[model samples]
Target: MARHLDLEEQEQLDELKHFWNQYGNLITWILIVIFGSVAAWNGWQYWQRRQAVQASFLYDEVERAAVGGDAARVEQAFKDIKDKFGRTTYAQQAGLLAGRVLAETGKADAAKSALQWVASDASDEGLQAVAKLRLAGLLVQAKDFDGALKQLTSGVPREFEPLAADRRGDIYNLQGNKDQAKLEYMKAWQGFPADSQYRPLVEVKLTALGVDVQTLKPAGEPAKS
Candidate 1:
């Protein structure tokens, strides 16, 4: 009986060795690849988190400088943010905020430069549109009518189209191009949403331009009897 048990154990050991011979290297390689991928993913996540944390702290500095109304400090803080975290959205936001503060303080050249950075380099389309629009307004104030018109000609997000048209209308009016001004004003009035808060402002503009808003109908809408 002991001899028979010894023979059966030997047979079982042989079977185990055969299985390992068939799949041992494959299993070891599969586990090595999986573990390597997990390590890489974790390392990437850590890097991203570190970047975000650093960017957030810098953004806080920018906000504080802005609130204090220190244009020079704001500009400096924005520069730091751009240098260190230009890949972050905070840098773009800093540009806009700093530009607004500069513009409010009558630093047109500085404001224009800041806004130009945001308009050209911002990753977010909405922020880019806003920056471009405000930059155009400053250009208009500086009497660079052609430059203002050029800024307005750049494409904006769909939501800003009406406002862009209205701004363009103003620029044309300033340039004494009444016909083009009227055309742009009509476009603004027509493009604006019926329920928009901005619609009334657009209405005022149209009224000033001798275009009655009440007489206008929705595009492709038939006239009432």
Candidate 2:
């Protein structure tokens, strides 16, 4: 019985060796690929976290420079953020803040450059809309009405439509087109929500154009000719 048991064990060992000889290299490669993927994923996560932390620090530098009225520092910090972490949210926000400070400091071209970068390159649609709106305002100030109109013509997020219309109205009013201005102002007035603080301001604009808000149809109703 002992001999018989030994023979059975020998046969089992031989079968195991045959299986390993057939599948060992494939199992080894599969395990290597799995472990390599896990390591790569962990490394990618670490890199993303590190990039965000660095970008945040750079953004804080921009904010500090802006608050101190140091345009040079603001530009330098913003450049660094854009160069190294342009894909990050902090970088996008830094661009907007830098643009505001640059514009306030009389660096109109620099401000426009920063705003244009955000308008063109920002991944977030809302941020892009804000950049376009602010850029349009700057162009209006420069009497570049055509440029401003071009900026406004680009698609904006839905929530910004009323403001865009109002801006267009301002441009038309400046150009002595009272008819078109009034129409655009009416569109803005109608587009504003009932509880919006901006609605009253639009109402004021309409009143200036000799249109009575009370006489106009309520929001969501078609306007009378």
Candidate 3:
């Protein structure tokens, strides 16, 4: 009985050896790939966190400069954030802040430049829409009507569409296209909700354009006869 047990153990050991010989290299390679992928993912997450931390610091500089009304300082800090962390949310917010400060300080060109960058490169659609609106306003002030229209029409997020239409109406009015202006203003007036403060704003514009505010309805409502 002892000799038989010894033989069975020997056979079992040999079978285990044979299985390892058949699959060892494949299992080793699979484990190496899994470990390598995990390492790469961890490295990527660390890098992104580091970038956010650095960007937040730089954005604080921009905010301080903007609060101080220092257009030049705001411009410089915004440039730094955009250059180093352009893909970060901090960069987008910095651009908007820098542009507003620059505009308030009468640096129209520089303000336009900052806003244009946000409109063109921002990842957030809302940010891009705001940038475009501000940029369009500056362009209108500069009498670049066509350029203003281009920015307003290029693309506006759904929530901003009413504002964009209002801006288009303003542009059309400025260009002496009263009919088109009224049309755009009506679109704006219809876009807003009944109780929205912004809806009243558009209604005022529509009133100026000779539209009866009471006759206007919410976007999907039928016209009263």
Report, for every candidate in turn, its global Cα lDDT versus the true structure. 0.86, 0.92, 0.93
Top TM-score model = 3
Error of 2 at 208 (Å): 1.6
> Which of 1 and 3 is the better model by TM-score?
3
Q: Write the per-residue lDDT of candidate 1 for residues 161-206, one digit (tens) a residue.
A: 8889999999888888888988888788778878978778878877
Error of 2 at 17 (Å): 6.1
Flag regions of model 2 displaced more than 4 Å.
1-30, 215-219, 222-225
Q: Judge candidate 3 against the unseen true structure and give its global Cα lDDT, from 0 to 1.
A: 0.93
Candidate 1's C-alpha runs over 4 A off are 1-33, 219-225
lDDT of 2 by residue, 1-225 (tens): 999999999999999999999999999999999999999999999999999999999999999999999999999999999999999999999999999999999999999999999998999989998998899999999999999988887978888888888899999999889999998888788888888898899888889989888867646786565
Candidate 3 C-alpha RMSD relative to the actual structure: 1.4
Ranking by lDDT: 3, 2, 1
* Per-residue lDDT of candidate 3, residues 56-131 (tens digit): 9999999999988888899999999999999999999899998899999999999999999999999999999999
Best by lDDT: 3
What is the Cα-based TM-score of model 2? Answer: 0.85
